[model samples]
Target: MIQELNDEQLERYGRHILLDEIGYEGQLLLAQKRVAIIGLGGLGSPVALYLASAGIGQLTLIDFDQVDLSNLQRQLIHNQQRVGQNKAISAQQSVELLNKNVKTETITTKLTDDELLKITKQHDLVLDCSDNFETRYQLNRICHKCQIPLVSGAAIRWEGQVTTYDFRKNKQPCYQCLFPLKSNQGSIQESCSQNGVIAPLLGIIGSIQALEAIKCLLELPTLAGKLTIIDGLTMELRQFNITQDLSCPVCS
Candidate 1:
């Protein structure tokens, strides 16, 4: 279905239109894409907002959390007035306010294996914005099985990481391939909530995840087989090539 961009859409996406890489055709592709973002907290906030502003047609958000006073520091999608409301619903409100052309679907319950498989199959891409390893691994597993692209991001204190898992491409590593099990670095095994992350760090990682999703949806070349790591303190970014492990339980 060809969607003619009205005056409002053209005005809203003027900068995108100016980009040589993402001309009118790329913009149209974005408008027809659907992305599922798991977790509407710090990371999901920027990803959802950017995707909506960029004119992504459909966005499915899953987060069992409610807006809390603590989340205000980093989770920009929710406000004090929305405290006690579900994060997914609050994020939906934020996206709708950003751009009415974007459709938002809020899932208020925790993501289960069955729900993850079903919801992931319906989207062109999946954003693993959740804070836990279990959630990230589960989303990657489903995406790999369904041959859907997955974008994963994380931030803690002065460190951050973002990667694209394009299972549709052979020999590309999924999240589980890189971090098979939870890191033994901490008692809880590297959770953002417990480890603490700088407020702006989420913005950096989340925005990158959004960019990766856009690139993946438009079939543009991206950081599919590399893990991009960031150091917030020094503002240094490094890329590590990742290869599919034949021993990986998810892909092997």
Candidate 2:
């Protein structure tokens, strides 16, 4: 059942409430949802900010890194003053500043697969804003097992991609289905640190991740089986259908 919105909440989310697609009922749904963001870097920054601003009742931030001067280039949730602080804690502080009504929690240590599965089971949605394929693969397996939706985003160099895996829906493709784990074995993974990334590229990708998470929480239509790719240099956007792998191990 949706809780009644207080005066402050009503005023704070007035714009969202005005939308026919996201009326007062939707706002209340948002206010009751719990979302876990598993990274606090470039992509995770905007995802955390927007979700907190949207009044997600609970946010669990998981990251083990510290804010560094180099992170300021794209990680907007942290400032120079916060350098050397745990990224998850820093993100929690930012979220509190954005909306104190949104409860925030931080996990400053890296999680093992079991730990990740246990914690993610407590949330309504999981946002895979982590930087590596190993984390993405593990999260996909866990979310698929738990039947929770996962919104995944990545930005590196001048390109980025966003996709959703609504594991609640049978036959839906997951991150592992799209990029088979075996295929990535022994492959070198490029990161923003290695290849360098355009600052705004993260904002674009992270914003989409946030939007996808909101839609998932509000029970609206989402890009559950499609990948949206963006070419920052040419400003071109493209989307492709993702099919579940019949013999795949994760979500088959």
Candidate 3:
């Protein structure tokens, strides 16, 4: 039998249950779902917080780095006091504080190819909040192999982008398609380190990533196979239709 929530959860999630789309059934589904976020930096911060606040039953956060003063600008979940603490632990603490009912698992080790498969096997969805291309590529491959859905987001300078690749969904492009093998060899690949990002820019992108993950978990309208790009400077937003590539090595 499916476990029913107690009075506290019912009341706490009353607003969500009130939605016709996310009525009692949807809220219950969310409560039973598990999600994993691979990075605990700027984007992962908001993703974990919002999901926990929304009463996601289980969240696994992975990050090898510790908190630093430089991260406070956009990594909203961690504070000055948390400096020197593992980011995964800090994010888990933040989530627990927001909602004690939510369960958090913190992995303070860098994710390797083997570890990725082992850990992600049990998750319902994976959120790629890592800033590096190598980690992103690894996540895409593993998730594709395991047939898990992935929601990825990136922010640098004034630009932010969010996309969901549901490999289970027929003909959906994986992250590798958008970023082909040829681009990986490029020299001008911009990153947060090279081109500084606006502080709130991370928040904007991270929040959207969380939203997308939530929707994906609840099996609602998601950004799967679509890219939503936002320009923080001008506050302009645009969505592009994306299709799966037949020759794409990752998912094809």
Q: Per-residue lDDT for 141-206 in model 1, tens only?
A: 889899999999988889999989988988788787787664522543667667788999999999
- For model 2, the local distance difference test gives 0.92
What TM-score fits each model?
0.95, 0.97, 0.96
lDDT of 2 by residue, 1-252 (tens): 337899999999999999999999899999889899999999999999999999889999999999999999999999999999999999999989889899888999988989988998899999999998878888988999999999999988899999999988889998878888887776537677888999999999999999999999888999988999999999999999999999899777
Candidate 1 residues lying further than 4 Å off, grouped into runs, are: 182-188
Q: Candidate 2, which segments miss by more than 4 Å at Cα?
A: 186-188
Candidate 1 backbone overlaps, count: 1
Candidate 2 displacement at residue 19 in angstroms: 0.7
Candidate number of the best lDDT: 2
Highest TM-score, which number?
A: 2
Better of 1 and 2 by TM-score: 2
Clashing pairs for predicted structure model 1, backbone only:
157-197
> What's the best-to-worst order under lDDT?
2, 3, 1
Off by over 4 Å in 3: 187-189
